[model samples]
Target chain A: MIRAQKIGKSFGPLRALSDVNFEISQGELIALLGANGAGKTTLIRILAALTRPSTGTAEVAGYELNREQQQVRKRIGVVSHQTLLYGEMSAQENLYFYGRMFRVPDLQSRIDELLGLMELKKRRHDLVRTFSRGMQQRLSLARAVLHQPNVLLLDEPFTGLDIHAEELLTRFIEKAVADQVTVLMTVHDLDYARDHAQRLLVLHKGRLAIDAAAAQTTRAQIVELIRE
Target chain B: MNSLQQIYTILHKDILLELRSKDIITTMLIFSLTVVVIFNFVFEPGSEEMATSAPGILWVAFAFASNLGLSRSFAREQENSNMQGLLLCPVDRSAVFTAKVAGNVLFIFLVELITLPVMVLFFDLHIGPVWLPLLGTLILGTLGFATVGTVFSAISANTRSREVMLPIMLFPVTVPIILAAIKSTSYLLAGRDMSQVWSWLRLLIAFDVIYFVVCFLLYEYVVEE
Candidate 1:
């Protein structure tokens, strides 16, 4: 469902990603672990077709980056540190806007279901700005998966989520994986990544340093890889 | 959905947001009114200076109001990185540009609509038979303002000093539109026949077309990170 071949990115004299290569099969939940400048978000942005790579190539859901950006964008969902939601608008309006953007059929019902699933049905009409951080994150998740994307890219989704919101997000992600949706998430939470992800990919200095199954690698080794 | 549906969807969202927050429209209307009110005090209402300067004052107010509105509109999109969310959709980038332009035009036109009547009343001008041509001139000028303003707003939004950047970048490129609009409005306000305003109107139409096409083509690049 996702492939990258020697994907590289440079910001002037600084290199953000260097010859990074990875692939995730359908239904796989890969946790991308990295330090602050390790280029996880850059890679995610490249795969989402939002940023053009300075070198190499990437394909998501069988569509090549840049050349088939619209097609690629249609199949993927993204949630970053920012909620990507309008604070002035209601939760329902945000979902409706995205649904219409994606041209999702039966959008009203889909929005209702997602709102209910995210436990936002009661506050659907409330302005998003007035919501709590957790509530906003949940709504952001709902906005992300609103179109039923084939690929889900989450960048530090748990940054400010509370325990309950974190659990809710985990379960939702599990459900998405169960439905054969590929997910690539970047996180600073090592324990959660090891516990929830099927595989782990660590980036050190903008390079992929480790690619291993979660069960086969312990927490100590993962920590060592990140520090190294 | 098709491109038209996509455009309408975006435009609807913008309109809905504005209706709820009254952010862009309210700021623009108030600012434009303030400009007109101040200018009314500066120039005597029934004097010959007022007759010659009304068009310039009107468009200057409009230009400043547009700058405010465009900056606020794009800043709203940049909030929470909503512009990236918009870009992530399956629609063409040009559709997004078109919708934004439409939204800006509507907001600016609404400001113009409210402010125009106030200007006429404040200056004690007799528009009489020229009202229809004046309307046409306003729409053309607003369209051209929006067409150029939308693209530059997007560009400036990415910069650090966006508030200052929008006007700095927009005003230079929009000279032809403002010049033509002011000229056409002046002729109509002077009670001249349509024959005189026609050439300025034609220039406005040309600027609108050229800017729309060029901006439509360049938007895909401008918005890309």
Candidate 2:
């Protein structure tokens, strides 16, 4: 589960997110929609405990963001625009390192399964830097899920992916949600979000401008809402 | 995993990466060796002045080379937000700090180990009688340097112009270590009894403990967002 109360964040001269509140129940697939500088990534960073909120509070997986960050971290997985994979290490090495770091059980088998799931088993021994962007993104996903975290947070995961890669990522997310992992992702592609996300949460000017069931809210209306 | 296990995992990862790239160790080794050779040219090999100054030159070379290694170590984490990824784990923050400190000490110590004999030969000093004491001084001094350097390296890594930021933040805080190392090293080189450098050794140990404890306690803040 995820909860935020009056979350506000600011850089010295710029306000990135302000007075935003939202909650998601277990296994809910929620997509956060916003344009550039709309605080989508900032919100996810706060949830991931990667950054502190200047004002208000956030709790993820029953742990307070600021007070119990380690516990919070234990329960969540994050995949951002940054791949977070070490280029110097091989794909399997990256997964092994994170799996061991998170104390995952039977890590070797789990890594193999994820590598196969990401279609990276063939390239598992190659260094990350030598891989294409799609391969890197897939490995990044493998790294995030290596621990089988209770919650998943992704920021613009489909940004640079080709159509095939995007579809692969979508299938993986669906599988994760089926396994009852609470999912929150930031997205620009309303069509993909409409088809894949059960709920849509939109942000504008650091405010929660829209929250609606994805199937009921047409893409045209969502676009108009974003424009407003 | 337990904190010690986590520490080994991190240290192992760094060592493997370094082995593959040969980036940090190779760069620091070449840079330090060049500096020592240059110092030989500057002070004139086998000169009496070079004998008195070799320890100072050694520490200076080690210090400059260390700065490069520290910068490169953290810079690897900066790649692809690997640092954030590491921080997101449930492990203690100090595990990351301790692992990095150990890795840096290993790399810098290797640099010194190779540089020392060349230093003795080029500077024309007898190291046979004092090798053990010299090794002890190098270990203590390197520990002091790595403890404080790790913290400053993290602080500077997050800033713009990180290359410029590292030395400025590092040098002031490490003054005690650098001073103690230079004095202790000089005394060791002079062929005096260990008691002659006791005061400097004590200072080095004291500073090493202080810096190590401070860095351990404060590392959470340094790495936190």
Candidate 3:
């Protein structure tokens, strides 16, 4: 569903991503594992068409990443550490706002379904500013999936969630994969990645260090790869 | 859907929110009235010279007060990282720019509508038939100001000194709009022939078109990560 070849991005003297190449097929849940400043977010931004590469080319959802960014954007959903929601508005309003932006058909009904799916129906009318971090995170998840985007890019999505929230998120991800949505997420939690991601791609110094199926690698081996 | 429809939907959402909260318009109206009152106290209203300069004073007040509105136009988005959600949507980034410009225009115009009657009442000045032409000039000038202001606001919103940065960056670029608005406003107020005022009006239109197109094109680059 997505292909990036020798993609590199640099900011003046700082190289954020270099010689990066990867691909993901439809319905695969891939974890982008990297330490701080390991170019994970940069790669996701590039794939999402939010940033243009300094070199090479990428194709997402069969559209050229740079040339057909709008189409690529339509097929991809993104969630970062920030909930990216309007705090002054209710969770329902936030989703409705994005639904209008994407011009989703039958926006109200879609918002209702998403609210129920994210278990936010009870708190849907309350201002998001009043929400717990966990509730806000769940709302963010619903917002991302509202358009039923084919590809999902999550950046540190589990950072602030409590255990219950994490479990709910895990179930959501499993269901998303079952529904045939391609998932690419950046994570620092190896255990979460080990359990959730079918494939793992590790980044070291802005380069791909390890790309393997989760089942093929043990925790010890994965740690050894990171050490190398 | 087309980009225009997408922009319209976003703009409609913002306007509905503003109507519910009454935040931008209320603040802008009160601020503008205070400015007019301050100007009145500083300059005697019945004096011939002061009456002659009333149009300039009115627009200057409107311009500055509208800047306050523009600053807060994106406040809701910036408050909780709502801008990221807007950016993540599939809509074109330029659509975001267009929607913001439209929203600012509406808010600024609403403020002007409310403030104009107040200005006329306090200043005790008769608005001539030329008031219609002057109103057109104000709208066009406001459009130009808001277009560039929206772009600069986004740029400054990400900076360390956003509060100070926005006015510093915006005021300099908006000199042309302010000058033209004041000039044309004074001409219409003085009841000068419309022909003579055409030059300033044309300049306002030209500035609006130029900045509108430039800002729309550059917005994608400004907001991209």
Candidate 4:
């Protein structure tokens, strides 16, 4: 579960997020849609415990964002545009490193399974810098879900994903949601968000402008909301 | 995972990455050696001035080289925003700080270990019975440098001109460490009695402990976004 109450964040004169409020029940897959500088990533970063909100408070997986950050972090998996991986280390090594940090059980098998799914098992030993953008994104995705986190926050996770990788991600999200893993992702692709997520959240100029069910709202409505 | 395990996992990862890439250690070794060689030429080898200046020269090399190493260590984390990834883990923030300090200390110490013999050979310096004390001084000084450097590296790694920001933030805070290290090293190099060097050693220990504790407590805030 995830909850945000009157959250705001500011950097000097610029306000990145303001009075944002939203909540998602367990296993609900929500898509956060916003244009550049619309505070989508800021909200996700707050929920991920990577950044503190300048005002109000949030709870992720029953842990308070401000005071219980370590507990919150333990329950969530995050993937940003950046791979958050070591290029000098191999793909497998990177996963192993995170797995150890998160104390993932049966980590080697989990790594092997994810690497196989990402179509990177053959290149598992090669340094991450040697991998292509799409491959690295795939590895990043693999790293995110490696711990089987209770809450998954993905920020533009599809940035460099190819068509097949996108499909794989969709299926993975479907499976994760089915398994009762709460998911909130920032996505630019309105069509994919409409097709995949159970709910949609639209942010405009540091505020949450729309919160609606995807099945009830068409992509056109979502587009108009984003435009507004 | 436990706190110590988390620390080791991070330290091991850094060491593995360094071993594979040979980036930080090699660069540090080369840069420090360059400093040593340049100082050799500047002060003239085997002269009384060179003998007197050996400890200062050695630490200057060690200091600047460790500066580079600390900058690169955090810069590596910035590459993929791996620092964020590290912060996202379940461990205490101090674990990350401790791991980074450990890695930096190891790399800088390795650089110093190699540079010392070269300094001795080039400057015609004697270790005598103070070799152990000299070694102790080097370890303490390196610890002080790393404890402070690791914190500054994280702060500066977020800034635009991180390379410039690191030294500006680091050297001033580490002034006591450098002064103490240089004095203790000079005393040890001169074959002074341990009693003569004890005061500087105490100061070095005091600073190292103080910096380590303060940095450990403040690291969580420093790495915050």
Clashes of each: 0, 0, 0, 0
Instruction: Write the residue-wise lDDT of candidate 4 on B1-225 in tens digits.
Output: 489999999999999989988889898999988888888888755678998988888988999999999999999888889999998898889889989999999999998999889888888888867788899999999999999999999899889999999999999999999999999999888877788799999999999999999999989889985
Clashes of 3: 0
List of chain A TM-scores, every candidate: 0.97, 0.95, 0.96, 0.95
lDDT of 3 by residue, A125-187 (tens): 898889999988999999888889999989889989988888888898889899999999999
Residue A105 in model 2: lDDT:
96
- Cα lDDT of model 2 by residue, A63-176, tens digit: 898899889998999998899999989998989999889999999999989999999999999999999888889889889988888899999998788877888998999999
Ranked by lDDT, the better of candidates 1 and 4 is 1
| lDDT against the true structure, each candidate | 0.92, 0.90, 0.85, 0.91
lDDT of 1 by residue, B1-225 (tens): 499999999999999889988989999999999998998998865899987898999999999999999999988998899999999899888999999999999999999999999999998878888888889889998998898888899999889999999999999999999999999999888877788899999999999899889999999889985
What docking class should model 2 receive?
A: medium
Best candidate (score: DockQ) = 4
lDDT of 4 at A142: 91
Q: Can you write out model 1's per-residue Cα lDDT over A137-189, one digit (the tens) per residue?
A: 99999989888899999999999999999899999999999999999999999
- Model 4, residue A57: what's the lDDT? 98
Q: Candidate 3, residues B1-225: lDDT per residue as tens digits? A: 588888887898788779768888888888888888887777676777677777878877787787778778877777667777777778878889989999999899888888778777877776768778978987998899899989888898888877788889988899999999888988887778888799999999999999999999999888885
User: DockQ, in order, for the candidates?
Assistant: 0.82, 0.77, 0.60, 0.85
Q: Which pairs of residues have clashing backbones in candidate 2? A: none
Instruction: Report how far off residue A178 is in candidate 2 (Å).
Output: 1.7
TM per model? 0.96, 0.96, 0.94, 0.97
Candidate topping lDDT: 1
Query: In model 2, which runs have C-alpha deviations exceeding 4 angstroms?
Result: A215-228
DockQ of structure 4: 0.85
- Rank the candidate models, highest lDDT first: 1, 4, 2, 3
